[model samples]
Target: MGHDKLLVLTDQVAVSLATIWEAIKVVRKEGFEKLDPLIITQASSDCLLFEEPSSTDDIICVCKSFEFPGDKLLANIYGVLKPGGTILVYLASEPPKGQTMQSPLERKLLLSGFLDVQTSESSQSLAIVGKKPSWNIGSSFSIKKSTPVLPKVNFDDDMDLIDEDSLLTEEDLKKPQLPLGDCEVDRTRKACKNCTCGRAEEEEKVLKLGLTVDQLDNPQSACGNCGLGDAFRCSTCPYKGLPTFKLGEKVTLTGSFLAADI
Candidate 1:
C-alpha cells in the first residue's frame, strides 16, 4: 500500500539479507512486483546515522552482530515505527553454546531504547515489534539517565576493572568483569556508601613470589582486589588464602593505598 524502509547492520553480504530480501524477492518474483523497498545499510558503529526519521513501522534494523548499541538502535526503531512494525536482527556469527546462553544480545536491544522486547528460542534472532505510545523525545526518554544503560561500580577509591578468576595480576592489562563484593564488607545491591575494613594481621596470600603478609597491607584495611564475592577473582586480588585479621590479630593485611577517592 505504501513505501517501506529497512536498515541492515550486518557485515555479511547477502546471507543476512536473505531473510528479509528473500521474502520480498519471492513475493516480487511471484508477479506482485509493485513493492518498492528502501534499504539503508549500516554497521553497528554508526547506529544513529539516520538522525531524521519520520517513521519506523516499515523499517528493519540489521547488525553484523546484535550487541549493546543495538539496544539503542531498537529504541530508534520504536520512535519512528508504525504500530506493529518488526525489528529484525542478524548475528555477526555464532559463538559456543556456553557463550550464547540467554542471548546477551537482547540486552543490546533493550539498552538501545526499544521497549517490551523479546528474544527468540534459537538464541540468535531477537525482535521488538510494537510501537511505543506516542510521546515527545523529552517525555519518552529521561535526561537524568542515559540510554543503553551500563553496570555501575562506585568504589570510594579508584579500582581496577580486571575480571575475577584471571590468573594474570597485571594492573594495566586487567580484563574487565562484573563488579562484585565489598573488600571490607558485603555490599548491598548497589549501596552507594563506603564499607570499612581493617588490615590483615596474619599471613597474607602471596601472588607470584610468596610475599609475606607484611608486604600486602600498608594502611588501615588490606585485601587483594580479588574476584567478585570470593567466587571469581582478579589478578590484583588473587586467591592466596590470606587470613582476614580479627579484632586485634597480629600484623600485615592486603588493601589499597588510602587516596582521596576512597
Candidate 2:
C-alpha cells in the first residue's frame, strides 16, 4: 500500500520528532498504511516558504515548541496545504491559570480561514484540528445570474379609477394662514432670548421700570392711553390692571400687585 504524505513542523526538533514517531506507530498499529513524514524545522521567517502552494496533504504542528506567533505559522501552513487537507496542532502544556487553550486555538484557526475547526482537550494534551476549504485560494468562478418574475396586474375597463384631487375639498387644498411676524411666541407666550419682534426692548424697559422706584411711582405713558385701563394699555404697560385715572394722577400699586405669583 502507498504511504500517506505527512508534514511534521516543529521548533523543538528532538521532543517533537519523538512525539510524532510515537503517533506514527499508533497509526500503523491501527491497520493504517505507514506515513511518509517530511520533517521541517520552523524558520525565523514569517512564512514557511514552501516551493509549491497547495502541495501538502496533511500537516502536524507541535504548538508547545513554537517560539513565534501562532497566527503567522498557521497562515503559512494553510497555504502549503492542498484543498480539503487537514492540520493537527498538538499542545502539550495547558494555558495560563484560569484560561483554556481551546478558545484561543479555535479563534486563530478560523481567522486564518480554515474550515471545520475543532479542539479536543485530553488529560495530558490539547489537540486542535482544522481543514482547508475544498476550493483552492485565489481561484474564481462566475456566479449564475437569476431573473426576477414580477406579479402581473390586471385592469378592469368597467371599474373607474378614483381621482386623488376629487377627494380634497377647497379648504383642504388652500394653503394654511401662518401668523405674519418675524418673531413667533412659544406656547408659554414668552419670546426667544434674542427677540427680533421688539419684545426684548419691551422687556428691557420693564426691567428698568422695576429697578427705578421713581418710574414705578410716577409712570410716564408712551402712547398717552395708559389711563384707559388694560383694554387700551400697550403690551408692555406697567399699570395694566390699574383703574382709569387722570393722566397726571400718581398710580399707587397695591400689595397684591407687588406680590409675585410663585
State the lDDT of candidate 2 residue by residue for 1-262, as single tens digits. Answer: 2455677766654565567765443324453345668876644425454646888777777656433336777888888888998887776676667766677677878999898888767676777788899997688999999989999999999989999999999999889976654344232244467777765565466465443322333555677577788999998997877888766566677788779899
Please provide, for model 1 over 1-262, each residue's C-alpha lDDT reduced to its tens digit, 9 standing for 90 to 100: 4445444444344544455564343223453244455555444543664545546434544444434334455566666564445454543345555566235655555555545555434444434332344454554555786579689977865677777658655874867665566543432222234423432322323433345444444322244333223443343443335544332234454355233554
| lDDT (0 to 1) per candidate | 0.46, 0.68
Give the top-scoring candidate (TM-score). Answer: 2
Candidates' TM-scores? 0.37, 0.52
What shift in Å separates residue 182 of candidate 2 from its native position after superposition? 18
Candidate 2: residue pairs that collide: none
What does the lDDT come to for candidate 2? 0.68
Q: Kindly report which residue stretches of model 1 are placed more than 4 angstroms away from their true locations once superposed.
A: 13-17, 22-35, 66-85, 92-95, 122-131, 134-262
